[model samples]
Structure formats: C-alpha cells, structure tokens
Target: MDVPALNQTSASLTLFCLPYAGGSAAVYRDWQTRLPGWVRLKALHIPGRGVRYEMPPMHGWPELLDLLVEDVQSSVSQPFAIFGHSMGALVGIELAHAIRSRYGHAPIWFGASACKAPGSRERKLDWLSCPEEEFFDQMRVLNGMPEELLQNREFMELVLPILRADFHLCGSYELRDREPLECPMLVLGGSQDLEIARSSESLSAWARETRAPLERRELDAGHFFINTHRDTVISLVADSLARAFHSRGSGVLPSRSYA
Candidate 1:
C-alpha cells in the first residue's frame, strides 16, 4: 500500500481519473488537452477493454483493486488527485484509503461523481444478468452511453460485456465501515440520473465524515455529466485544484468560478 513518490518535475499536480464501469482510459484521453499546464491528467484503464481488449474482465472488487493499484503505481509518479464516476468513484475512495495507509500521503482532492456515498442502500437492477435489449435500455435510461452507439449493433457487441462486468462489480461491492477521508472531497451528481438515488446527500455525508471541505454540484444532465458538460466540469475541477494548491502554498493560481 506504500504509495510511490509523485513526480515533482512534470507538474505541480497530477489528476488520476477512474472511468465509469465498462469505460476505458480513452474516455479521458483528451483531458490532457483541456486541463491547465500545471495539472497532468492520467486515466486508469481497467483491463478487458480498450487496449487490453483480450484480457478477461475483473469480477470482484478486491481483485480489481489489486490490479488497479499495481497499474496506477507503474503509470503514475507525481502528487496526484483522483476523479471517479459511479464505479470509478468507489475505486477512487478505496484507492485513497489504500494510498494513505501505505504511502502516508492522501490525495490533495477526491472528486466522486454519480455515485452515492458508501453504505447507502444497494439498488440492484443487475445489468449484467439482464437481457441484452433490457440491459442497453437500462444504460439509455442512465444516459451514460451515446445514442448513436445504442443503435449500433457492432458497437454494442464490443462494449456490452465490459459494461455488464462493471455493473456487476458495483452491484456486488460491500462497504467496510470505516472513517471518512481527510482529503477535500467534491461530489458531482446528474440532475436527471435515476439510476443513482440520493447521490448528492450521500456524497455530502463524506464531508461530515472527513470533516474536510465537501462541495456538491448538480449538473443539468444525466449520469454522464462529463460528456454533456465537459468544459464546465473541467473548469470546476480546475478551480478546485487551484484552491487546494493555493491553500497548500503562499501563492498559486487564483481560483475561478464554476459555469
């Protein structure tokens, strides 16, 4: 669990992103171009998707975590923050705990999107076991996947399994009662996402537990707020990072307002 030292030369901060279930690092590939020069964005690519298409998908949370920590350790070296949505949100939270326990340094910020706080009542629609058409319908309801892709048979064939596996992981996750994080937490929710209930209040609970700065913003979109509000989301993230850095040092970039 010992976290490796963050890269000091590349930039002052790095952002380690975790994708939604059935997603890949490719989702955030363009983020580097969008973020400020001082921040480096790196997306954690879960196997069995994208570049690792041949590998089998992960079935359990612990197994997935072990794989992820190893992968992240190898790919990242700088003082970094974590941003995860839905399934990725849980990963980010657990990863922060792991890094702190092992490396002794918590991330400067933790951005959790589209997920309720840990220990919330489980909502088990079970996309993995649902019929193909029904499963896609569920995704459409959540507004995560694109409309064009929904009708593309070939695309669905390629992406559906990964999505199912991710849903399964999220469905199966069991929270271990633990203390709240000490790092600043930012929770984002989609105003129209029905799949995740009470996302704002649940995420806000993190503030009470961590006793750290917690802010919740509801976007006028569905579960995939990152897609619909990319620029706005990125700007908010940049502002948060600026504030975190400014608090850490005497002078840094001035914080900007969210759109």
Candidate 2:
C-alpha cells in the first residue's frame, strides 16, 4: 500500500482526507497531530496535485470516482473514516456509495464540511466554457484561490487547467437517486460561509443521505472553517470517530499522549 506514514504507529482507524478543488493530499499533512493516536490520517492524493502534478487532473465524475475507488481499495484492510471539505465533500458522498456497493462495507463515519448537499440546489455556472478573465474574476470574488496566484500570470497558467477541471466537475454534478449511506454522518458548516449560503436547515438536508442519525455543527467562522477553527474541527472529528468505533463494536478508541 502507498499509504503514507503507515508503519509509524499502531492505529486502529484510518481517516481518509480529501481536499477541496485545486487542492491536494498535502493540505492535511498536519492533521494527524491533532487526531488521536488510534486514528491514522491518510490524505488522498488525487491526480494533478502535489507529487502527482505531472499527471492531468480528472474532469468528470465517473472517471474520477473509478480512479479513487481503485486507489482506496488497497487500503481497506482496516476500519476507516472519510472527511472532505467543499468540493471534497461532494466527492466523499459519491465515493462512500461506491465503496459500499463495491466492497460491501461503508465507512464507520463520514465528515462533510462547508459544502451543499448534492441535488439540493439548481444553481450552475458554465465554468468549463467561461473565459479566463471572467473565471478569474469569479475566483477573486469567491476568494477560494490565493491572491498571489491570481496576480501571477505564470502561476495562473499552470494552475488554471486544474482549477477549471475541478470546477467543471463541480458544476456538472447532478445527484442521481440512490440509497442512503448506512453509517453515521457528520455535516459541518460555517455560520457565515456565504460561498455555500448554508444554513442549519440546509445543512440538515444531509440527513436524507444517511440512514443513521446525522450530526450537524456550525463553526463561528467563514467559508474555510476548517482552517479558521482547526482545534474545534479536530475535536469534533476525534469525538465522532471514537463514537463510530464504539458503535461498530470495535470498543473505545485508545487514549493518546499528545506532546
């Protein structure tokens, strides 16, 4: 398995971290420190990100899910959890369904942050066909990309393809009718995240996607709540994972000594 930092410790649960659009596995490199010792953070390295920069980024949902499923199967020997933010949240939802259908087992827990539930809204942007200047203008308003990258023409040239590909996938998303997930789901959002315009009621819509009771939380922050409230996010994740282990009859999660 190409699982990073696998043999370093004795972990009982594996947490698969998915990044948002224009993001890579490296985004969660520091997450393990805040997680419990029994949980191992395996950040999913999607194509065209980080070390895989040489490869082209995926542009469609089917192809992306197929590739992800193949990569994830190799690490399914142990109990695992799934976490994603923004665009990553959408990927996590479909990926969970795929994993259960293929491997016959759902993740112990699913964590979705700062994203609208699939099919909840009909708003669409022609991101794939949008002119570079217009798209860049939108990115500036959305504030998802760094100002430095947007200002640097060369940097923009290099990242624009990946950004457009990601947005294309996001814009083209159409949720299909399917069975709800069997595991407990934790839906989190920012109180002031204008990007998604998510409210408590809107966040609760995720309940339709899970058979188990859904847990919803809102951080007193903006769109990027995970970074703004890292401590709170990590605490919630650890607590949710612990409960998941307990529910699966895996017993309680082991206590960790954080230095």
Candidate 3:
C-alpha cells in the first residue's frame, strides 16, 4: 500500500506523535509552537475519536498498524521521529518494526512514554465486567477524564465504551519475542504513575532491544505527565530530537550502554 502524503516545510526533522488511549490528535495541538524551528510536529489521529468519529474504533492490532503505517508513510518524508504515550507507545514500537520491515526506513528517535518495556508483564484488569461506577473510578485515578464527564450521564454514555475498548486493547496485548530494534529508544515514566513501577531502572530493559542508544528519564508527575508537566516534557523531547538529528548526520547514534 502507498504511504499517505506528507506535509512538509523547511524543518530539518518531523515528529509524528501518537496519543494515549481515548485521546485524539488535538492532544498535541500546541506542540508545534513549543518545538524549535528545526522540528515539525504532527499528530496521528485514530478513528472513533476527533474528526474520524464516524468510523468504528479498530479492535485488531494488525489492522490498526497497517492503517497507521500507510497514513504515516504518506504524511511524512523528512528525517522523522515518533513519540507515543501509553497505548500510543505500543503503537509506536510496532510501527517502527513495520517501517523497517516494509520501507527499510527507521525513525531517528523513538520516545516511549508511560509504557512498560516491550516483553514486560502485561497488567490485566477486567473493566468490561466491572460496575460502571467502579470503572469510572479507575479512570479518575489516571487523571485523564474530566470531572464534568464523570457526573454527566449523557456524556458518560458516549465516552465510556470507547474508554473500555481502549483499556481492553492495552490490557490484552500479547508480546512475542523478536530481534532488537536498530534505533534509539527513549523511555520516560512518571514518578507517581501507579501502573508503572516506582523505579526508573525497569525501563532500562528497553535497551536490550535496540542497537542505538537507550535513555531513561523520570518526570515528577503521574500517568498524564504530558499534561501535568507540559513545558518540561516538551523541552526534553525537543532537546533529544535536536541531538538525534545532529548524531544522525555525524554517523554516530549514541551507544546503548546502560547506566
């Protein structure tokens, strides 16, 4: 399949961001202004959310990846990077594998935020079988759902299914062993994210799967660190992209030596 048409400007790097489950492209709306002139930012909007609300949400992983790979390959052409949070992180990693296998182009850098390392234990929660109120409470703990929606029955009717489906997809993922990726992996976690382990050391396992460098940074926020620490998160990502751009040209992608 042909890749989607890329929107290009003069920027030296293009970043394709994937949002967390139940999130839309709008989640990264302000990122363009925050990034340096050398970098261009674009967000991939999955169906059943945002403007594509008419389309059904994708439940199968392979189908979802195919659609994303087609769209992303069409939409970007410059030296590019990817940043995915939570469910998006898994998507980003799988997309990396797809791009390499199909197009032979690898992202210069990959930012996997708020996700366990590939092949890590999957946390299972049967939200579908739980009471509606109980399921909402779990979402509240994650800090993404707005208070107004939780109280409004009409709004809950529309959003709850999408949320449940997303949670199910994430919780049910099965990891198959594969060769290490040949690109840099930047793993970021929030200090207070209850779902992820407290120690940043667990993130280092991601290094074993990449030939390029591995870097880990912990933010002093919870699961939604992107929202809670926007400035800090953006700055760190910008700096890493700049460094990756420079390193790519120098023919020295940093070594993945665990600290």
Candidate 4:
C-alpha cells in the first residue's frame, strides 16, 4: 500500500481517501486543490496500482483490510475522516471498524460514496468465475475507464488482474457482525446505480452501522458518477465536513463550505 502525504496543514483534519475498484490514488489527485486549507488529504494508493504497481493486488478481504488498517495507522497524524468511492466504501467500513477497535479512535466522520450499503447488494457477482471475454463485457458495462484503454491490450493486461482481485474482494465480502461506529455516517449513491443497490433507500441501510445519524443523498448519474459529477460530489463532501466539525464545536472548519 502507498499513501502520499498532501495538504500538510497545522490546524488540519486529515481525510484519508480510498479509491474505487480498479482505481488508484491518482483518481484523487485534484482533491487537495479543492478542499480547504484546514484539511489534509491522504489518498491511499493500494498495492498493484499507482506507484505500487510492481506489487500484486490482494484478492481477499482479510489481507486487504489488514493492509488498509496498517496504512492508516502509520500515516494518520491528527483527527481524521474517511471518504471512499465504490469498492473503497466497503473497504472504508472495515478500516474504520478496525481503527476504532485497535486504536480506539473513530474518524470524526465516514463518507461512503457510489457504493451500496454492505449486505444490501442486490446480487453476488463472481467476476472471477467469468471467462475473460465475459469479464471484459462486464467492464464495458461499468464503463469506468475509457473505451480506448479497454481496447489497449498493454493497458488491459496490466489492469485486468487488479480489477479481478478487487472484484473478488467486493463480491465475496460478508459483514457477519460488528459494533456500530461512534462517529456519524454519510452515504452517497448514484441516482441511476440500481444494479448494485436499488436506490438511495437501499443506501440508507448504512444507518445500521453507526451510532450517529446517517445522511443519504443521491447524485444524478450512474455508478461512475464520481467522475461525471465530480464537482457536485466534492462540494457535497466539503459541506458535510464543515457540518460535522461544527457540530462537535471544533474551533476549526475543515472545508470551504463554511467560508
């Protein structure tokens, strides 16, 4: 795992970000510029991607979560928050749970974006079981990457394994049991992403995992809306960060939404 430090501010709240399936920390390269000066963004680059490309992806939850927990444990420097998209959202839950259990500090807030609430998935998708052609077909349906990259054999060869590993983690994951988190939860779903969870109502299932109120909002796009509707997504998160910090009577605001 690789986490590059960005937005080093003294009075800051660190926001540890995780990327969607098949995505690297590169996806959040511009976030540091958009977030306010009081927030430090540490976008984790999971192994086998970004600067860690030589490494292999972990296909199971236990190993992946262990790495995630370790990465956060070593990198976090202050009161922190977590924001993840798609597969990252699921990973964030386990990461936060682990952080609280082992380190005894829950993030001030949890932001889950473009993912269904755990256990609410409509159906299991074993992408690993699919033949190569069929698996790429699903990729076409997801449309996360550019069509040209899908056509580029060199790029596809490098990325397909990572995607497969990530999908295996997502499809096979089960939330058997865990205690609710102490901090608040914010859930963001794409308005058109019914293939995963039916709708925002389905996203609301996240309420079961947090002691604080769950805030669910649906953006006007599909599963990959984080790109198509990037500005809106970022602004919503900024506003939420402001609200969460202010609610705690923290003297500093973390996002420009308050300004």
Task: Show where candidate 4 strays beyond 4 Å.
Answer: 1-11, 75-77, 122-125, 146-148, 197-201, 252-259
Using lDDT as the measure, the top candidate is 2
lDDT of 1 at 245: 60
TM-score of 1: 0.84
lDDT of 3 by residue, 192-236 (tens): 887776545556777776888988899989999988898888878
lDDT of each residue in 82-198, candidate 1, tens digit only: 998878888888887776665666787889888877766375647667888888777887877778999899988887778888888777777776667766778888878886654
The best candidate by TM-score is 2
Give candidate 2 misplaced runs (Cα > 4 Å): 1-11, 123-125, 198-201, 253-259
lDDT-superior candidate, 2 or 4: 2
Of models 3 and 4, which has the larger lDDT? 4
Reference-based lDDT, each prediction:
0.74, 0.80, 0.76, 0.79
For each predicted model, how many residue pairs clash, with residues at least 3 apart or on different chains? 5, 0, 5, 0
Q: Write the per-residue lDDT of candidate 2 for residues 37-113, one digit (tens) a residue.
A: 67878888777879888889888888899988887897666787899998888899888888988888678899998
**lDDT comparing candidate 1 with the true structure:** 0.74
Candidate 4: clashing residue pairs, number: 0
Measured on C-alpha atoms, candidate 2 has an lDDT of 0.80
**Model 4, span 201-248: residue lDDT tens:** 557788887888778888878888878888888888877876786577
